[model samples]
Target: MIWNIYLIILTYFLLGGIGFYLINRKKDPLVARKSYTKFIVYFFIVNGLFFSITIEPVVFRYLAMVITGVGMVELIRLFKISGYSRKSFFATSVVIFILLALGFCFFATLNKNLILFTFLVLSIFDAFSQITGQLWGKKKILPHISPNKTLGGLVGGACVALASALLLRKLLGVSPVSLLFLSAGIILFAFLGDVAASYYKRKYEVKNFNDLIPGHGGFLDRFDSLIAGGAWVALYSQLADI
Candidate 1:
């Protein structure tokens, strides 16, 4: 456990810290940099809370409920403020909220290590995508939805995310077969999640979700991939019977 803690810290600093800096430090006003920095802080805060509350299972559920509550409120506000009022959309929101909130809490309660490690893997994918896209991306995959996303970045992110799954296989305690599944999950779903968020942003013409997280836009902005990825992971775990 102690050594694993060290490993987690080292991985966060090496991959997340250096990777974020390399990818985001060239901005003119440094908004990206500030956002990346706050992401680090937010990461710690969330994981700290997760680990600390592991002793009481209900605490995790409570936190999940609180998050869902906030999300519900945010969705309502978004619809109202954005001048969108549809009963079916609101119903869809309720369904999504239930699935996400309960599913995430179930994972955290089931295996802290798995869930936390999954997050790190997502970060690795995101960092590489951002870095590779900015540095060498040429062919835009779908410039309409997300201008910055490129073919190179998507390929690079997937490859690196798969590589990371291999490297952290023992830490995550999965076999070669399971590794393949999760690698695909992290890459495919994470990309979809991010792009989905980007599409919503484009549709709404909103720069940042809420500016609640300093440089990271809103809580939803920061957790977009995690939200999508978590639901997928939970479903996969159940379906695979693993």
Candidate 2:
């Protein structure tokens, strides 16, 4: 089990390094630098998540709380920037932070393997969705909300993510039936999370949730999919007993 975790970590960095390097190649120096920064920060974020899960459940719970607290701060800032009234902000914040807290708590109780699987699916889908979208996405699916999301990108990313899930079934010890549902849940929720965040950004007239993570904008900006997708995975794990 431990070896498998290390393997996933190795694979993540290898693929991430190659992908970022290729994408940054031939780009303007400043642009490439920004891309490099994004990649570095992303690496840290991914590893931090991995560490949180691999450690004791109590540790994971505390880490999750810290993350939720930071996320709430960012959300509060967004609400203030958007001029939400105090009542509205407090109400919305309670609802959102509650859901976010529950999501993280549920996630902490998941089987380590399942947690890793959820991460794998989200990472692949998130990365490929944007890559294919940029390379071949012409028709904007949500132009007003998320201008860059396209049908081609969504389709391409889903296809690749599904394929990868199947290919990793044996390694991950996931049955085919469970893999199908899990993959679907992760992809759908991840997309919804992205769209949901984008909706707020558009409505608030903000480019990102915040500028906390440099190129990644903020915790919400980067991990919205994980929050939503992980929650689905946790609920599905309970329901399906996977």
Candidate 3:
């Protein structure tokens, strides 16, 4: 299992690196640099996630809590920086934090294989979406909300993600029908989660939630899809009794 994961990560990084390099080679040096930085940051995030899930369950639980706590802090800071009154959102913020924390904790408790499968799908979707969008994306899906999101990117990402999911069907030891549903759920929710986060950023008029991450906006920005996608998976697991 461990070897499979290691191979997956290595292969993904190699493929992603080639795509990024090809796409960014002709761009402005600064823009290309930023894109590479984002890739490196994503690499670390994936590794961190792998570590969290592979560690002791008790420790993973606490790590999830800590990451969620930081995300909440970042959320609050975003509001404050945007000139929003904290008191107005105090109650709502608290509830969101609680739910997010619980979501992460829930993720920590999921089967390791399931967790890896989820991450792998998201990674494929995210990488291919951005790469394809930048390369060939012509139709903007939500120009007002997120100009970078394109129909081309969406289709490309979903296709690649779904293909990867189908290829790795053995990861979850589930029926083909179940795997299909799970992949669709992850892709749909992950995309929605990203759009939802973008909606807030548009409202906030902030480029990023914070500058904690070099290329990725912040903790919340980086993990928004994971939180939402994981929540969907958790709910699906219960409903499907997986």
TM-score, every prediction: 0.79, 0.85, 0.91
Cα deviation at 106, candidate 1, in Å, is: 2.4
Task: Write down the lDDT of every candidate, Cα atoms only.
Answer: 0.68, 0.77, 0.81
Instruction: Give the TM-score (vs. native) of candidate 1.
Output: 0.79
* Least accurate 10 contiguous residues by lDDT in model 2: 85-94
Candidate 1: lDDT of 34?
71
Alpha carbon RMSD to native, model 3: 2.2
Off by over 4 Å in 1: 8-12, 15-63, 85-94
TM-score head-to-head 1 vs 2, winner = 2
lDDT of 2 by residue, 147-166 (tens): 88999889988987888788
Using alpha carbons, what is the TM-score of model 2?
0.85
Whole-model lDDT for model 3 versus the true structure?
0.81
Order of models, best lDDT first: 3, 2, 1
| Candidate 3 clashes between residue pairs 3 or more apart in a chain or in different chains | none
For each candidate, C-alpha RMSD in Å?
Answer: 3.3, 2.7, 2.2
Best by TM-score: 3
Model 1 clash pairs are: none
Q: How does model 3 score by TM-score?
A: 0.91
